[model samples]
Target chain A: MIDWLISGDRPRSVALGAVLLGILFSLAFAPFLFPGVRALDTAATILIFIVLVASYDLLLGYSGIVSFAHTMFFGLGAYGVALASIHMGPGWDALIVGALAGALSATVLAYAIGLFSLRVRAIFFAMITLAVASAVAVLVSQLFQLTGGEDGLTYRIPRALTPANRVGELFGVRINGRILAYYLLFFSCTALFLLLLRIVNSPFGRVLQSIRENDFRSEAIGYRVVAYRTAATCLSAAMAALAGSLYAIWLRYVGPDTTLSFEIMIDVLLMVVIGGMGTMYGAVIGATIFVLAQNYLQNLMGAASDATSALPLIPDLINPDRWLLWLGVLFVLSVYFFPTGIVGRLRAGR
Target chain B: MTQTLLETTDLTVRFGGHVAVDHVTCAFRAGELTAIVGPNGAGKTTYFNLISGQIGASAGSVRLLGQDITRMGVARRCAMGLGRAFQLTNLFPALSVLENVRLVIQARRGKGFNLFSIAASHVEMTTAALAVLERVKLGALRDQKVSELSHGNQRKLEVAMLIALDPQVYMFDEPTAGMSVDEAPVVLDLIAELKHDSDRTILLVEHKMDVIAKLADRIIVLHNGALVADGPPAEVIASDVVQKVYMGREIADV
Candidate 1:
């Protein structure tokens, strides 16, 4: 059963397996365990980032194709949800339609971009995606009425998905639309993660990995390197779009800053690298570590500053505002210590 | 001629006015092992590249079983039964030796695009891949990653992949280029076994005169991107022009 669940691709390390289970159980019962609004949001955000980063890994890790337009697909999904809510009214039907629309656009755009650039080479794919993503970001911010401009859009979903609509009281926690929404994200993300796991273990996934190892060899062996790379790009883009849809649905808001930011792309890259680039479980671990750090690192710094008030220059150096600097330090330390990322480190039994 | 399996017409390629391969035409046939021999800069490898679709021709066409395939890319040509093994041992280095061969079989079976098929559950495919691995005596190292394998082992894995491909035309660019003195015979024996099939067309590029004399039935010598000699191995080796251009001047230059 475990083999079927993970598609026979074990974590290959007892510690990694235990940590993954810890994460899974924690995420599965997040509301009951955490029971706070901010914590719930952070957990959901982590789940969303897991899907996004794993999708990107399909292109970069599996196929050796580096694309920078991941957020563009993510944004399209968000906007699809936003536009559907605003135009077609707040219904589950609208959500489905919006998600389908978003995924379709992302897939088509990815196919177009991949066909144009992937056939040429890797660097060209990266450059073209960066340019296209930037262009899309500018277009989203410029088209005020259509995409809500720079201010973004705020819309509503069904009452069962909001904070106030309490279904009942279970234990100390409120049984409300918010918890339902969280569960929705949880199940979807888990299914998506497992699906990705299955894909990487499939024959198609082998081809992609082979391409990463040696494209000329793959071609000589009868696999079309460009076609496989392009297919990977399209699939990754669509998955990112689905993730964006869930993100919009969770927040009930969509905007360039939230979904289309290039920073998010960089974060995804960092997460993929930090967790382990070539595995789906890497996304799970990397996104959890990163999202947790992003949220509570500031609090840790503020508390450190308070405790170190008597120290000279130390408090200022470790100030809450220097979280980004500390994050950089953390990234460097990880790359130094793990080299292949934490998952890789654990898998190697080191 | 047994059966013309592959033909090239005026096949040529230029690297910026430097004609790496001049207008050379030849036909490869079933039940024949043709050895392409050359001195340095004779374009033997370039001609292989042209026929295999690794590079576009400046002025030529490649016909496989009477189908024009000059414009087809590497993968397409491979799918059409044009199998090529490189001198450099191009292989998926991070994957297991079993997987490296299994992928070629999957590709030949048109199952490379399958998204949900568990590779291990494909019992027939696994057995077939294992059989191919055993052919090159890599069955024991099936689970070992190609990157970790020795250079000679990787070369053997390359031939395993080629055997799995089961192409009509088998092209080897110095199959024994980097093997040890002992390891060279394994690949040579495999090529000899394939040559016994009688319906398969084999093309080889080799610098080792001993290897050429042993495996190749026909020898085609290229000098400065042009065909200099074509006949039996003994005839070509003893030919006056080949003795002078290939053995004497080129040897002196080296």
Candidate 2:
């Protein structure tokens, strides 16, 4: 089964694995197998990031175009739903409309960016996107009325998704709105992940890979390089917007820091790089590992620091509040040991 | 009776006071294999680049089948049947040998925009790719990564990709550049075969005199970014100016 899953040129096995992983993650939130609210929440966050980073990989890994504007699209999606819910009143219908609105806006934004900046050199394109994204981040933070300013926006989700609605018991666990919300996230993320997998394995994807390898050759072979890159940017941004919408729904809040911040963009970059740049499976694995480590590793370090406080030198290095220092060490070690990222190493092992 | 397939009228490219391809006006006639020969920095490659639309001309126009394509982008020019092979062996290095050919085939077939269909499962593309690979005699190495192939085989693969494109005009820039003497003939033979199709046109830049003598019906020699020699191969070889600027005393002695 492992061979069947990992040994193919096509992405079907990887797509299947992603779907299965999504289902398992959703199941972890169930009461009987419950790992607690914090763990379940972390798992849900990981699933959402899987979608973000995988969509990101479509550009970074598949097309070899790096832009810092992904979180802008993501934030657009979150804000789309948040604003819609506040104005139109919270319900499933409004949420869907908001998600669609976000996706459309992101697609349009990406198309415009692609038109203006894609013709420049890659490094220049990156800088252009960075400048544009920073401006948008500042705009979102300063829009006191519409965006709720620096404090961010809080709005209602669908009644069915809120904790007040109990959907009945399942497997000795009382299934409620929160569980429904988890499953909702699971199914949507899985579907989006699968769709992206199919796209990257398609003829279009082949051309994107060709462009990445040799843009001049791809152009010489009759591929409109700029057009294809634009299409990829739009597709990646739209998917990211969808992930962002899900994030807004799950949290019942949309804040600049949580959605459009540069830190989130950096996190996605880290996920793709540590996961493996070119492999889609790398995104899934990378997000899971990174999110889990971010959530649990700090607490684990805190406990260790307390335990080792009497040990003098060890206490300083294992500082509880500075747990990210250890994670930084782990990240450096992983990059050194598995230079190609985890999925890259796994694929190489195969 | 052969018609002009491509013509560049006073095509000029200048880089900050340095003339790379200086006002080269040449025509590639259908059903002929024309060789552009010169010493290093003779602007043969730059001339090819100007015609292939890889770079814009500072001044001049390229007429392809009577259409002005000077300002056209590389992909559009290629779609209009202008194919090129790079001197540096540009290829999808990580892709399989088959995939490199298949992408060209796919591009020509107009399936490059198809996002929903699986590339590997496209039987038509695979069949076309395989046929081109077989023609180039690299069919046995189809599944191998291009990086794993020998430099000679990679050069052949580049030709195969162009063949799959089925361009009306082919621009070859040192297709045999890095090949051994023994391996050079294999590519020369493949290029020779293209001349049998009377409607196809070939523009080649080569340094090896033997290969030029064997294949090029006509030779256009460039010296300091200017065309100094243009005629049949034997006449061009015997031209005093060609010997002075490009051929040098060595080929004259021979």
lDDT of 1 at A299: 97
Task: Note the Cα lDDT for every prediction shown.
Answer: 0.91, 0.87
Question: In DockQ, how does model 1 score against the reference complex?
Answer: 0.83
- What residue runs in model 1 are displaced by over 4 Å at the alpha carbon? A310-313, B248-254
lDDT for residue B106 in candidate 2, whole number 0-100: 90
Q: Which ten contiguous residues of candidate 1 chain B have the minimum total lDDT?
A: B245-254
> Taking the candidates one at a time, how many backbone clashes does each contain?
0, 0
Which DockQ values do the candidates obtain, in the order shown? 0.83, 0.68
Worst 10 residues of 2 chain A by lDDT: A2-11
For residues A1-350, what per-residue lDDT tens digits would candidate 2 score against the true structure?
Answer: 43322223443345435644664555454435654678668878988999999999999999999999999999999999999999999988889999999999999999999999898789888998899899999998787888998999898887888889998877777777877898898889878887787788789999999999999899999999999999999999999999999999999999989999999999999999998888887888889889989998878887898899888788778777787878898888988888888877765665
